[model samples]
Structure formats: structure tokens, C-alpha cells
Target: MNAHDPIRRCILLGERAPRESLIRLALSPDGAVFPDVRAKAPGRGAWIGVTRAELESAIAKGKLKAALARAFKTGPIAIPDDLPDMIAAALERAVLDRLGLEARTGNLLTGAEKIEAAARSGKLHLLLHAADAGTDGNRKLDQAWRVGKDEEGSDLRGLALPVPRTILAVALGRQNVVHIGLTERDAARRVSETLTRWLHFIGSHPALPTCETVSQGASALQIIPTGAGNSVADDDTCEELE
Candidate 1:
């Protein structure tokens, strides 16, 4: 765990972990259970330090309901039967929202040329590739990032986001967005953390084979391709690429 990530206790596992590593569940006044992917919801929240599969297993065995009841110290709370799907949707929205915010704030660079230029300049803190991005395109940008440097004077290693091109293009309000490079570490960290949580929530990370490996059949690539999901519709809040 990084020293910066706050430590929180998982009510179910009773283990201490980074706050960002745990999923937060909030309780409504009516005793409804809500997954707080951003951890921004109000009221007392319970933390869980389990992966998506573990969470689903717990829910299936009726263990999660008991754990939540214990954590909230209340009578049986209403947990939606489709709680996993709901949480997955919430996580997707949070990631897209963060991407949109980053684009609006000029902290994100899209398009192959712009992103590759930034990567080569050693100004890029993170590199995101759409799940459907062609292997050639991904390779070029990954090479640029390999030759780049971080702000701390260390070699930069590019990390691929699990989001698809459709979602990425919609989120950034750009046409055919296949690549994104984050210029600031803080912004990159925020996006990475959110993406990691989403991937974990969906049971995609550290378990399933990445899209890159499946597509290229080459172990040389460093990208971990994300699994497919429903597309997020475009919104007026996203600014068009200039």
C-alpha cells in the first residue's frame, strides 16, 4: 500500500487496506443499500475489501447482507438483487465522469499525434488505450511512453485504461478517440484509481486475460485490455476536441 492511500477497515474481512482499495457502501434513510464508488456519498458508510467475485459470492451465500447489517448496526437493509450490476454501472459512470472532467480541464490529450507527442516529451503521466484500438496504434504510443520520463526523473511506464473507444470518445466528446494521455500525475492517479476500482468491481483485473494478450497473442505488450460493457451515451457536458 502506498503511504498516501488512507487506511480503512473492511467490515466483512476485518482487514485494513487502502481506502481507495475498498468499496464503500452507503445506507439511505429508508435503509436502502447503495454502492458509493466515489466514496462521496453522505451518511455512515461501510467498507468491503473483496474483489468482484468475492463480493458476488458473499451476496449469493447471503453473507454480504449479514455483514452489512453488522456494519450498519441496523435491522436487515434492503440490498437490491441486482446489486452487482448496479455497482458496476455506478463504477462505469464514475470513470467516465472523471474522464470528462479531465478533458474539460485541459489535463487530457487525445488523438494519436497529440498523445504520442506528449508521451515522447516525457510530460505524460498515464497512457490510456481504447479496448478496440488496433495493435499497431497501441504499439507506437507504448514505445513513445517507454522512452519518456516522469516528472520525478524516473522512466515512465504507460498504463492502459479498461474503457473502450466508444465510451472514451463519448466521455471526451471526441470523434474516434483511441488514445488518451494524462499530463499530470494527480489527474492520472485519480483516473487510474477510479479505473482500477471499476475493473475490480467487474471482476476483470488479475483474473481474466487482458484484451491485448488475447488479440495479439504476444506477451510483449504491457497493456491490460478491459472487458466489454454497455456504452455510455454522449452528453452535452463533454467538450468537443479542439
Candidate 2:
């Protein structure tokens, strides 16, 4: 979504809310995802992340109940026992498991410097910009976008890197990339699924624009070292294709 554009505040809530039975919250905001730890019961939802502390804070402050009532413009409903933690853990595990799978498949790129190079190459179908990474890191890497050459072979610089917090970086990745990029068709599909969960569990945020391709050193990708596969230093981009 455009940064300045009004974010579509729709929620992608779960089929079952994290609350007592009969209580339900919808996750659609305007168009995409939203976290709703608070107000996740018996009414409309207030978006929240998949963090345990946030859930606890909501419970302690009564924010969870109040928000639900506020969203519904009604009275408060009871919060379920440990529902917040359960929800957060569930979300966290699901996110990490997916990332691990992608990592194993040679689809995912972790580590900042590694992806930074990828960002520069314009080879990225998606740049998994970390939600927690500072504005500067986000900006610098986002700068890697070189607009695609137009029909006249003139550089338009029109193309910007698509940075979707659109995807999630998780507590599991350990640092914070809950962020992920996608290039291949299958990987992109997994990215989409991950994106849906992010939207459903995490609230809306401004995502960066997308870039085209990143040129690598070799005409073909060579053998890449593990643990560095997600590294910007890895020179295996076209090698796999070759």
C-alpha cells in the first residue's frame, strides 16, 4: 500500500476468535491484514500484533475488552483465558515454520546484508523489508531500485522496490525479518499465504514499492555457501538457473 495512501484497515481475523465461544471478531479492515489481540471477542476488532506482551497489556489495561466494545459501540465482553498467548504463539510458530520451509527450499533470503545486495540488483520479485528495521535501513535498501528501462532504452527510474511489511518478519527468525521476499512462482504463493496470515494477525502498515531484478557478479549463479544463502555476499543468483 502507498505510504501516503490511506491504509485499508481491514482485518484478516481467524475463523475462530481468541475468546470464549459465541464471541467473534472480524479481521477485515479496508482491504488487507490487521492484528486484533485486543477486541478479539464478541464484537468488532481492534487490530494488534502477534505479541504476548501486547496481549497482556491489553488485558491488564482492559484495553482488549474496551476496544471490542468501542469497535462494536457496545458493552465489554469477557476475555478468554490465555487466549492472547495462545494466539500469539500459534501465529509465531506458523510464521517461523513457513520461513524455515522456504529457507530449506532455497527460496527465502534471510540476513540484512545479503538481502541488501538483492535489493540493489533489481532481481527481487519482492524485498522482504523488516517492519522493525529503522527508517534509514529501509530507505537505503529501498534505494536499490533502478527504474526499468523504457521502450526507448531510456531509464525511467519509474520502478521502485516493492517492500511489503506486506510480509511478516517474526520473533522466530530471531532478529526481526518476519520479513520475506519472493521471486519464484511457488515461493511467491507461499509469500502470499504468509502475507494473508500477516494481514490477518498483524495490522496494516505502509509497504514499499517493488523492484525488478538484481544483477549478480557471474553471468550464472555459482555454488553458494549455506548460512550465507540469504547473504547479500552469496553469488549464486543465476547459478541455480544455469
Candidate 3:
């Protein structure tokens, strides 16, 4: 949608969508196929516009294999039986890698007190809770976020990440990271969009609204409005919890 967002046609759906919204699958020189979730892989690539379930359906019906053969103009590219699992794992790693990068860049704050203070000060763009975090703690933080935004009249946002505490702590290189706050809007968008895609891929519908809904202020998590031209492809990764 934006100047930098490229449009690619999905080989399966034949529909043109922003590159970020489609999944990229690349063929290596030796004819091996791998899911290029980051879209930075080398060699020729094909795009698919379907969700994970749809992709699985395509595989089940032999459509994906046939389509890939046609796209690559090859006879048969030994499609891995666990191709879906491979893509899922790669996406998960990409999400965790991005989180780690954010932590290293000091754009992320962990720990309840630090996150709460950031939220209270209206400096937090997003608040992320681990999936396995206690309901009491989650409620307390949600209340704090609401109170802080109410006081400042700011429309910040928060969500429960699909990742559990153990994965979050490991990703952040911390001991126990139950909660996290992102102070940067770009970082928050990246994290949220990636997580959303992952959840969709795994057939898990999150309770939160889509980014557009959040940006429109139609949801409880008042996200800062990103311009209309931004597309889902702007978020570079995807995955679900184990």
C-alpha cells in the first residue's frame, strides 16, 4: 500500500496483495524449497496468499505441490512432508529474534514494575503479557494501563502475546519475563502484526481486534493510528506458541 510496499500475486489465489501479507517460499539453488518468512532468502521465490489452514488444505489436496512445480517450472521439487511445521518453526524463530533485537536496542522494558511505570508515564506504546501469566497480574496491569491512558487521554494499546513466560524470558535474555512494554510505535506494530499473523496461521483467533480496528480506535486497545497506506507486509515475521 505504501511506496515501499511491493505487490505480488499469490500463486494459489492469483490475487495481488502486498508482499508482506503473503508468505514467501524460496527455492534454493539445489532445488530445495523453504519458507522465507523474512522474504530475504536468496534465489527464485513464490508467494502464497492463503492462511495456514488454507495452505494445509492445498497440501492435502496436492494443489500446493502442483502449483510449486508450475511456479518453478520444474518437474517435481521434493516437497517436505513437514513443510508446514518448518514454516511455523521459522516464523517462531523470527518473532523471537525480533523481540531479542528490541530488547537489545532498549526499546523493550520487562518486569512488572518497570512496565507499569512506563505505562503510567504514557511512554509505552504496547504492553505484552505472556500467555501463561496469572490472571490477577494481567488484570492489574490492564487496569493500570487503562488508568494511565485515562489520566493522559492517550490511546495506547496492549495485548497478550501467544508466547508463554519461558519463551518470552528466553527471547529477552532475562530470568522471568511475564510482561513487556514497547516504547516505540514502529516496534510495537512490528511485534503485534507478526504475532497476529502467527496466531492466524495456527488457527487461533485472538480476542483482540485487527490492526486496522485498533488504529481506528474501535477497540479497547487504543493503538496509535498508522496511516492508511501501511500494509500487513510491513510486519516481517509470523509464528504461534508451542
Candidate 4:
């Protein structure tokens, strides 16, 4: 992170972190709390860096209400019982929307052949797989990425998204988007930022396949080297075929 990167404090966690890394909760005129994943809502907002389970627990114990009441300076803050789910859904949408934008710009590559070529050429900045993509397919592409990066013996691999191929296809307006390779550095950074926040918020959802979990295969995608000019990776434009 740059020395001038904006920072915010998480109300529940009481820890300072990069503003974009935390989830923002915007308040309606009636003091209803809503997810502001894009951070574009024009109003006072509170931030939280807790996971879904932690948020749910806070709500059950009335901690979140108290925190919001304090943050919004209101006696009664309206928090929906489904606030955690709402946040998760909003974050998920943000990730998919980003991928769509990147896809439209032609900054990414799909299809096993194309991705593998980019990976082998060391031009692939970020690699990702649909949750339901075949394991053998993912491994093949991951090995190509590692080989390109010259980390042949390492565990570097593509991320297995929490959503399946059907959802990915709809998001990118393509069919059977089993894997993706972002070729632009900026594009990779942007996508990685969005994906990181979503994964951090959701923690370990069951939809993520164990074999492709970040801890298992894609840990290298979590943080880009500071010298690489970004703290995370994933953004770019790409037109997907098939």
C-alpha cells in the first residue's frame, strides 16, 4: 500500500485498514443499514472488516446494532436480519461486475488453450477457474502459469471462484467460462482487489472447491509483490469466446 492510501476503521473490529478492503454500510434516511460495496452511496457510512460468521454473531448479540447506533449517532439503527447475506450478495455482485467489465474490454483470456498459452508466455497476470471447472483442467492451466512465472515446483495456481461456471458465464456474457487469464497488470490488480474483499468477507464458503482453495492452490494470487506496483491483482478488459 502507498503511504497515502486512504484508510478507515472497522466499527466492529476497531482496527484500521485500507478503506477499500473493508465493507461500507450506508444508512438510509430512516436509519436502515445497507451494503455500499461500491462506496458510491452519498451518505454517512460505517465500515466493517469482519467476516460473515463474525457479522452474524455480532448481530445475534446486538453488537452490530450498538456499533451502528454509535457510528450513525442514532438511538435506533435498523439492521436487517439478513444484513450478512446482503453484504455477501453485494460483494459477490461487485466481483462478477468487475469480471464483466474486464471481459468487455478484452483484457482477459478464456478457453484452456489461450489461457495456457498466456500462462506459459509469462503474460498472464492473474488466473482464475470456475468453481465447477474440472480439476484436471485447472491443474493443467495452473501448471502452465507456474511454469511461466518460473515457479515450476511451487504451488502457485489459479483461484477457484466461489461461483460456478453458469454464474460466471452469465456474468461475462459467455458460455462455459471454466477458466480465465487476465493479461494486463492493472486489470489483474483491479480484479484481485474485488475478489479479495469478497473472499475475505465470505471466508470459507462451501461453494469453493477444496482442491482449488487459495490456501491449497492459489495462495500466490492473494498478494502481489509490492515491487510489482500493486498490493493485489485482477483487472482488465477481455472479450470472451465460448
For TM-score, the strongest prediction is 4
In order of appearance, the predictions have TM-scores of 0.77, 0.40, 0.80, 0.84
lDDT string, candidate 4, 9-114, tens digits? 6778765556667788888887788999888787567878888888899999999888887777755678888888899999999999999999999998889999
Candidate 3 per-residue C-alpha lDDT over 1-242 given as tens digits, one digit per residue, 9 for 90 to 100: 24555555567776555555557887776777789888887555787766678888999999988878777775458677888898878777877888899999989999888878877776777777888888888777766776666633434345677789999889889989998888887887777656655665666654442232234322111122345343332211211101
Ordering by TM-score: 4, 3, 1, 2
Runs in model 2 lying further than 4 Å from the true structure? 1-79, 111-113, 146-180, 205-242
On the 0 to 100 scale, the lDDT of residue 76 in model 4 is: 62
lDDT by residue for model 2 (87-164), tens: 645554555566567766777775657665664564545555554456666554445533211122322121121333
* CA deviation > 4 Å runs, candidate 3: 151-157, 207-242
Q: Give the TM-score of candidate 1.
A: 0.77
Residue 7, model 3, lDDT: 53
lDDT of each: 0.67, 0.40, 0.68, 0.75
- In model 3, which range of ten residues has the least summed lDDT? 233-242
Window of ten residues with lowest summed lDDT in model 2: 233-242
lDDT of 4: 0.75
TM-score, model 3 to reference: 0.80
lDDT score for residue 68 of model 1: 79
Quote model 4's TM-score.
Answer: 0.84
